[model samples]
Target: MSVMIYPQGRTLSFVYGDERILVCREDRPKVTSRVQIKVYPDGRVVAAAPSDIDDHAVLVAVKKRARWIHQQLRDFRQQYEHLIPRQYISGESHLYLGKQYMLKVIESEDHTPQVKLLRGSLEVSVRQRHSGNVKTLLAEWYKDKARDVFARRLDAMLEHTLWVSERPQFRTRVMQTRWGSCSPKGCLTLNPYLVKASRECIDYVLLHELCHLAEHNHSERFYRLMNQIMPGWQSVKEKLDGMAHRLLLN
Candidate 1:
């Protein structure tokens, strides 16, 4: 599909194999025209073409660089091993409420594995001492915590937010990119991964989405609403974004 990105330029989305690349035409002045391709952590590719170059030429350039792009993406996924194939082993650090805690695995006759926080560590009890998916235990615990925390925070914050006739419904989910999203039907979904974030960051995300319930877009008015409700949100958002690389529960 094509999008009218500028007055005289357009952007295209190209799919090679299973990967979708965003071809962007950027206006550059006082510099040599060039095509620069970048891959984000979320596995999205952005190909920046010179403004003067038309969409047809940009497609040609992207095709020529497809081999390099594929290689780079492969290397990136290899480097970001933390984002996948989580090893449920002892001594690895995990984040909870913005604090790092070591994992301590304990085996017992009780078959059902349970996770608990004690002495700045995640004490996980498992039935099979030899092998089993302990990651499931931790993930289940985090999901429950995410639901509880988001509900309580949203309840307290909704009172200070803008107009609403009915109370919004809340749910927890595992999302790849966004931390949370608000539906038009007053249903707010939060990322279960947020269980690892600080209390302040959690509040910021919930309030940000709550503001969206009123404004629905990040316009000046939306930001004004955010400022009026929660002043120090941008900083907390930045901090939360920074945790994406380190706080992976895959």
Candidate 2:
């Protein structure tokens, strides 16, 4: 079959053997001086090109870096070792605050379904011995903890960010490819699964989004602000990315 030609601003793909490398094309002639390719930790390859460039040229650039892109994808996929689909049964391991805790499920006739961290284990008490109930109970517990943790971290991060005067409205949601995001209106949306990482990592993600309040895009100014706020953010980001699959495991 012939390859399909993607539009200028649409997502494209470079077929590499059995794996298809997704290419996200960004067109910005003034801001983008040249074609620059960046592979995110989530295995997303983005190509920022001048508005004048054609889709074929961008695909060629991605093809040139195909070897490197494959390496990055391999590394990220290796992090998924031992992190399979969760059964939500007893003896399963779960993460809380960068620590692993074995899941302990208990069925009680008179008690309500609840989740608690006790003695290095996540104890889930449910009236029925169903995995769905256990999963729901655990999700609720994580959401509550994430709300409190994200709020506190956001407050602390604001002190260092001199650009943001008033605190932005923030909320939690379950995200597949992002830890956090700042809207054009300055509202921050964080992933509830982020609470599974360490406090330092959490702060890093919050600060990244807060920087968006000052600079919306990943421009040089945005990175400069990120460096000014946290010099070692790149390393922290690497650490978080290294364990993302485990933290996001269901």
Candidate 3:
């Protein structure tokens, strides 16, 4: 697809493969033209504009940064490919609420598949005579657990922040790129694959969306507020950047 440039000087571009990205402007003020690039946790890229900027300037910036963009895309693909081959087998390790647990598959006569969390272990039970795939059963179990955990965290964050607005609705989606997003209407959507990440990373994403409730744009003020609410947010963000590609793959 051709790159689209806004008359206001914002540039939009995309890269397609195991992961697809649509890059555009997050916010553009009427004053100074400065270049700012932000990579969304889900892999989307947003480049800001300066009123004085032009297409040639944007092209130059993209070309100067081409190596970095390609490196990011390559890393994302590698992380995803590495985790896709994972199997839910006995003794395999998995992350749950920021902690690691060993999997223990139990064959039972029960009519439905069930997953349980015990002391440092995850026990998954499936009907002995059923032909259903074990991987599918376990994946469903993970989704359910992710929903429950994320809901509880959301509630705590809302309360702790003393946010007075209407509660934001939440949904889980299977996204190739992006950890979460908050719409203008106060709805927050999270990637279900976040269940594969550390709990801190998940909370980081949740807090990010919650911050959007007060500040829709990622301006200096917005980041200051995030830092006030989450003192270690920068560290958390760094860790999240490292793991984002792996989680997307899962």
> Which lDDT values do the candidates have, in the order given?
0.70, 0.81, 0.66
Worst 10 residues of 3 by lDDT: 1-10
Candidate 3, residues 149-213, lDDT tens digits: the string is 88988887777565636668999877654678888887888877777777777777888888878
User: Where in model 3 is the C-alpha error above 4 Å?
Assistant: 1-84, 128-132
TM-score of the candidate numbered 1? 0.67
Name the better of 1 and 2 by TM-score: 2
Number of the top lDDT candidate: 2
Tally clashing residue pairs in candidate 3: 3
Q: Give the residue spans of candidate 1 off by over 4 A.
A: 1-85, 130-132
Instruction: Supply the global lDDT for candidate 3.
Output: 0.66
Give the alpha carbon lDDT tens digit for every residue of 83-162 in model 2. 46899999998999899999999999998888888989999999999999999999989999999999998899999999
- Residue 155's lDDT in candidate 2: 91
Q: Which ten residues in a row have the lowest lDDT in candidate 2?
A: 1-10
What's each prediction's TM-score?
0.67, 0.75, 0.65
Residue pair clashes in candidate 1: none
